[model samples]
Target: MSRSPCLLLLCLSLALPCMADEAKPGHMVYLRAVDPGIVQDIRYASAHNFTGHPLDGYQAPECLLSVDAAKALARVQTALNAEGYGLKVFDCYRPVRAVADMGRFANEPGDPLKTEFYPRVDKQDFWRLGYVARVSNHSRGNTVDLTLTGPDALPADTWTPSAHPVDCTAPYGQRWHDGALDMGTGFDCFDERAHTDSALINATAKANRQRLNGAMEKEGFSGYSAEWWHFTYSANTQKPDVMDFPITPLAP
Candidate 1:
């Protein structure tokens, strides 16, 4: 006996995986698809990032990560939600092309976003300063740059070409408003103050960093000391090394 079309469709739904599990290249999934509770501010997808221009290979502002990593992140979000705090990711699952774009920008002659992103440092020295790496772990799909947010977090601002750029290391209230708790400095701030354990920040910033680090650690995410917002979930499902998949938008 042949099955009806609708029945066949229902059977397929049960037999195959959901869009979240298959929309991405091998084992990768959008973080929001897994946990919408976590906020996302993918600056590299827009002019709001240090690159000034949108980075290459970022077709959309979506946070993509390895399956194991996304599940670990979701667990962290659940834990933070209970405490009235949430995770806000800035970058995830970057493409290798985007990393190359960063290197090209670093070697170029212009510094349009200098005031806001790397004020005190020169762009040419980004590699030496350890701000821009020739090979980024983000391409591996398990690393993420994120911040913590709570009820009192500042409101994120709308960025435009005409918007004035503020120093990333400027005091919390004076810097670009990203609706994140003051973690010493803004996300991607190349200044020493952005260091996870920098002593220059006030008591509040220190406490917030500690809290965010502790929460991520509890979920098995390793925090990068040089960048307060950087974390990596060690158990990656995809293992061919750096990925080149473009971050495409979810089906509307």
Candidate 2:
């Protein structure tokens, strides 16, 4: 027998929410499409990251962010550009599987890039120390990891699998040259010195950090205390869910 009209309506209503949930992360767009001026140095797509290898699902070295976040970041870039500074992104729109891969890397024994990325910290303590999150906001499509670039910043060096590692917490010029202004430490430094308000850093580093923080904060991004490069776009009204879609290459 056919179902009653009321029952049919209830069933249809129940399915609607599930159908709506599937449409999330669809708003994700290439950051360059919005602002090519925002330099990208996506580490997770290469072997330069803490893992010493490209993370899973990062098929391309591109930055992806929600539409709102991208536009807001573009505004920040424009503001900074007027001051002779621009944003250099390290990572963006991380996939859910990449987060899982990071967890697994921390749980395992090897630490090939330990000397540079986490010399003072143990891999197993990454999650407990707040250096790495099992569920990153980047998977939600609004968080970004970036730094500032200016005239004084050194040119970015080409990273290869065989390059020797340097201490990430060392002084600005002593660390790897990532074509970014001094922000106390290098990207992905898992030490306390990488903290946004760490006292160990010199005055120059502190000033740069404050400058970057102020710029990003003005654009609706909030910096994570543990890592200065980390920021989440809070101005967006859309509530995005975690996504595992592969990071694919953008069209040329």
Candidate 3:
């Protein structure tokens, strides 16, 4: 029952596209596929995160977001590029397993990254203080953690845990340099200084935060009050369902 060579070639061509479409479901799309201009740091996929180790379910350092959210983010990228600024995403479409892992790490009775990420907050109080949660808006795929970066944004600074650790409350430049615009505090800084409208930050940091908020808001995304870098798209047709899919690289 072998098909002719021409027939087999036609069948293969028809099936390839379908297989590729099935590979990545319609709900979640790799952000780079939708908008290559967006920068991605994807901290959970690397040891540079608060856990001091890579989190679960991050098979690749890629940003995955719900289809609608991805489209909205692409629009935001377009708007920011015009202003000579760019968006650098730290996290997007977090997995349920990763959120659960965060809970476990928070309760594991250790503070390996405390000085870098949560200087003022105790690990045991992470859930109580609204830092880590059993469920996350990120799991729903509409939320994103991001910051602004200019053409001259710096790269992440080298850190050695054995050295006297710098407090998360340290001045932006003095602490970890994430190559992003000085937004008062580094990402995952569990302190009042990371608040979206914190008055203690310098003028430049305040302006940078405001600019980020404004740009995100213009694209119909709302900022979280506690974490200035957090935002969720609000124009979605339906409420997002929590997802636990592992983030893997998309097929070429």
Candidate 4:
């Protein structure tokens, strides 16, 4: 029952394609590694986030983004750098586990950071108001939450819970400032003032939002109307697929 040499070679060839498919690298890339100029804050990796805990699956404080989206963001960083500004990302390529954690936390009552992050919004209303979702674009590895920062971007506060809680609807600097330019509200502020085009914000904050929006748009990123700091690289030809890979450190 010995097979002919030609038949064996054909069988090997048939298996090669399948093996190659299995060997394809994950499309995600570390943003800071791709562009050293871009800053990463990776909020979910730390306890400063609205969840008041380190979210699951954020194994490292890194910004993971699809290769194409990272390249596009690098271009945006370059454009911003020329204008005496740079991009500071708060979150990118969120793991599905982390998104699930957010959903679970939203369902539980008694939010510790509720005053700072969602004072006016009830926990149950997050899904109804489109603030929290079971699935997020970040899971697709192309969406990013970010803000503009200058060379003198303020340092992050010590982050101890304040004795007097501040409402998320308070002025940007009066509430929680993340060193980036005042974007009308802090990152993840679940309030109408955080809307991309909310007129309640001061003129300076409005101009800053427009500046970031214009820069991202120039590089083919579309801003989310409900969140001033959120944008997605829609120019990518690949269809977005949600992934659950943990944010691990990139190899040196």
Best by TM-score: 2
Better of 1 and 4 by TM-score: 1
Global lDDT of each candidate: 0.83, 0.85, 0.81, 0.80
State the lDDT at 217 in candidate 4: 95
Please provide TM-scores, in order, for all candidate models, with all chains considered together.
Answer: 0.88, 0.89, 0.86, 0.86
What is the per-residue lDDT of model 4 for residues 110-220, given as tens digits with 9 covering 90 to 100? Answer: 788887888888889889988887668887889999999976556666566454557766766577657787777888889899999998899988988998999999989
State in Å the error of residue 92, model 4.
Answer: 0.2
What are the per-residue Cα lDDT tens digits for candidate 2 across 97-208?
A: 6776897798888998999999999888988898777567888889999999999998888887788899998887778999999888999999999989999999988999
Segments of candidate 4 deviating more than 4 angstroms: 1-25, 151-153, 161-165
Tell me the lDDT of candidate 2. Answer: 0.85
RMSD in Å for model 1: 9.9
**Candidate 1 lDDT by residue in tens digits, 1-252:** 233344335335544221221135767889988998898989899988888889977889999998889999999888989999999999999876677689889988888889998899998789988889766789778899999999888898888999999998888899889999888889888889998889899999999999899988988789887899999986544443666667889877
How large an RMSD does model 3 have? 9.9
Better of 2 and 4 by lDDT: 2
In lDDT terms, which candidate is top? 2
Provide the global lDDT of candidate 4 against the true structure: 0.80
User: Lowest summed-lDDT stretch of 10 residues in model 1?
Assistant: 14-23
Shift in Å, residue 38, candidate 2: 0.8
lDDT of 1 at 171: 88
